[model samples]
Target: MSSLSTEHKLPEIIIPEDYNYLAFFISLNCNLKCHYCINLNDKNSARKDMAKHHMDGSDWAKAINRLNIGRDDLPVTLQGGEPTLHKDFYRIVNETDDSIKLDLLTNMAFDPEVFIRNVPVKKFTREAKYAAIRVSYHPGYNDIDELIKKTLRMADAGFYVGIYSVLVPENKEHIDDVMARCKGLGIDFRVKEYLGFDGEKWHGEYKYMDAISQHERKSCLCKTTELIAGPTGHVFRCHSDLYANRTPIGHILDPDFRIEQIFRPCDWYGFCNPCDIKVKTNRFQIFGHTSVEIKDIHELN
Candidate 1:
């Protein structure tokens, strides 16, 4: 792990005026291993070994604080195999600029009392349809009862919290039961569309079928509206590249880093991650939006 000096002022990374999402994978390490983990969805073996250097909380704050988001609707999302697993998770959140809103995606594996004591509620508070602190409830991997207790505890403490779960085909029955229970308790419970294969058929609503087909590699020009940074502060073209540990477009700590909105060349089009190509809701809950766009696709010889 590395830390940034407080005296150094890194160059501003101006987020494109049209950019929709900004994500920082603080640490890819997690406490649970779900069978349907999206980070390991790639056909390649690169994701199996995700042992990479991570930026400490101070450095992460320094790198993130350099961003000029210029929008109130979009918050800097802190996610990971589990973001709370980062040693300085609280420090990173508290040290970030007050002007920047923050969002957290986690599995709720931490102590809620410790979180409430360390985190400021205002930092994660925002006017949105969903909660700012979004917790994923993996049916078999995590306990829904414990999650409900933690969520209610946080909510009572003035934090906006919501619970989400993927609608895995086999787990649908249990998920539905949990959703009803949560709704009865006045907790925000939502279901996400299951992506990837389910033993027999491919699942998910994707714009480009061939992108997630995993059949053959193809050449194409890809562009993204999201600013995705890995644990090492390296910005990737898309989630597919981020999880696969592929080459990065630039490092966040680089003094000259800037957001470039253009179509870049790609050779692994068929092995795309579902999060990039899935037809899902945008920040405004508008449907039919995809994170990355691919064009000029052709068979690779």
Candidate 2:
């Protein structure tokens, strides 16, 4: 991975207003293996671990700092199976320029003392609809009391933190209980609509129902507002490509790599990831937004 030259620099790539999110999937190696992880994607086996192929913190910073996010409201979200699992997680957080606002998605499984010492309070603080550090609470894998303690610890340290759980059908009652407990403890708890199949029927609201049909394969012109960066600095067109380890649209560290805000032709319409096609809330918590805008669903034959 190479960095751009300071003397002959390419024009700064500005994040468009329509671009809802920028995700840096630092690593996919999670400490807790939840059964209903979306990364599985109906696959019979687990995807190959790419932790060894990840880019260095400095390299990540060099590439990410090039982006011109002109909005005060939008922040680049750092997430993964567990972003804290990355060895250079702190370094990457520290190295990113102060101009870039960061939001973290973690399971709160990491040592809070180490994180508090390394990451500045201001780095995660901003005027937003939700907390900066959003921790996921997986029922069986994560203990509610422990998560609350950790979140409160971070919050007491002057860092904004919150807890979110998926409303899986089986865990619906449990999630509600957890949310009530969190609210009682003064924690900003939120719930996300689960987005996968449940044996008989598929869950979630999607812009294109056929995108995840698993039966139909069609060619379409697709465009994404969100920039999805994988562990090894590879920028993917969609979440499916990122998780499947398919060919990326570009590499972040590559000086030649630049974000194109226009639509590109795609042939994997029906095989799309649930996250990409799922109709969900935006940064402002407004509903009726999908990550990718797909059109021209044509038959392969």
Candidate 3:
């Protein structure tokens, strides 16, 4: 079927009533594994087994290509365990239409020369104030000095690069030290509030703690403004669905697929992923947007 005809046949993906940002997981395959990674929040081995497989680079590029993100808001975000790890990373980046504003989440572990040789500055940048290239700083796996150097090199190459480190309980002081060092070196460094459990306890900044605890469930209406694509073409409602290997709502390649902005019922309210359940601000920096919602949950045993 022709692209235009397919689009016409497909239900127009209605952006949620107050949709703001779209986050696409180019691949869940990351090189550096943080101990406190939220992806492991749902420890159900059975659920993890059900996760979707990775999609091909061409298909990924094609799927992302169909998105209709408007100006200033930025287009789909290309992220993963490490998007650069994908065999067709460069191709996907270069293949995407020029109109879409691209953002990257990386570990900055790739060869800068390769990045500089093939990708232009405009490919991964926008007029937005925040740096486009968000490099995660895992103190355990990455060297801060090297991170600073690499980011500086990217900055020098005209890439809007920055560093983001999760504030894990054990590494707060080290993180502070790294922040000071990066600041002195003129590299963009920021911290993400840690999310998930670490054996003895739970940590994060959410009021609806039990909503995600899984020990108890409270149903509430949930909707998402972000577009989450697993390694495969399967699109998920929120991080929980993606990480828990829940079935996807639709695939970009399928002509029948279109985004729905409605609050769909989710039975696994207790299994919410921190990324989705967390009450964080939206793209416009407005607070109070929960990706998933439950209408009627039982608190009884």
Candidate 4:
């Protein structure tokens, strides 16, 4: 992990009233090279930028601690190609303020013993619709038996954990079997709808029809309910902007930065990322929620 200069004062940033979710992309490098990864589905995806900039655990703590997350329903989600890939994974989790709950999305490739010893079970506990530590099961990169063993071990240790798999066309046949086995083992297994194109057709249900069309590009005002933080503490207005390495709206570590709820004009509406426009379940596990809100969807004159 790289150290940031500490000479400057940090800001006491407040969470926006309308903010619904926090996603921290701690690192984009993953152990498993899953072919269906939505993060790598586009030309603008930041696969090359992963190694460029990443903050030390202390810096992450200082910036994230400033956030006043007031709702029990909202949590600062630690995610990445694999968040645990960060060198200070344990320190980051331990250092974040306890008042703000945490959620993690990971692949079960890590040592459970290390995780059990470092992460307190209570830090991840919150009143929510789904598990706090979400484990993504990639059939080709991982085995069901091994993943089950890991999941069971964590659950036995009193952690809020669950297994989820993307329902790709090729994997649809195996999902039911996997779900049944998970149910038999007393695990909370879920099937996630695939979000990208499958060579034949696009998979997910989206709020905007042309927003994700690859060939079309348009201008619009886009607002997001998500507060997205990249590895180096840069905040972005949308997923497309983040992955493309476009100039960030602000940096969390900057003393002057604050969350703004108003919509901002965008020139790449039709080329929006699927993750932002896709219709999916929210923190409450309620369906019919999209990450962003787009208005004035029309071609630039």
Question: How many clashes show up per model?
Answer: 0, 0, 7, 0
- Put down candidate 4 lDDT per residue, 138-184, tens digits, no spaces: 98888888889999999999997999998888888899999998899
| lDDT, candidate 3, 32-118, per-residue tens | 667677774345664445333466666666666676664556556788667887788888888887877888888887988899998
Local distance difference test, each candidate: 0.89, 0.84, 0.73, 0.84
Tell me model 2's lDDT, rounded to 2 decimals: 0.84
User: lDDT by residue for model 2 over 42-110, one digit each (tens)?
Assistant: 353324655546776777676668889998788889898788888888888888889889999999879
RMSD of each: 1.7, 2.1, 3.5, 1.8
* Candidate numbers sorted by lDDT from highest down: 1, 2, 4, 3
Q: lDDT of model 2 at residue 171?
A: 95
Scored by lDDT, the top model is: 1
lDDT of 2 at 79: 91
Q: Model 1 over residues 33-108: C-alpha lDDT tens digits? A: 8889877544556654553467888889998899988888999999998999988999999999989999999999
Say which candidate scores most in TM-score: 1
When sorted by TM-score, best at the front, the candidate numbers are 1, 4, 2, 3
Model 1 residue 278 CA deviation in Å:
0.5
Worst 10 residues of 1 by lDDT: 42-51
* TM-score, cand. 2: 0.94
List runs of model 3 lying over 4 Å from the truth: 1-17, 41-52, 217-221, 299-301
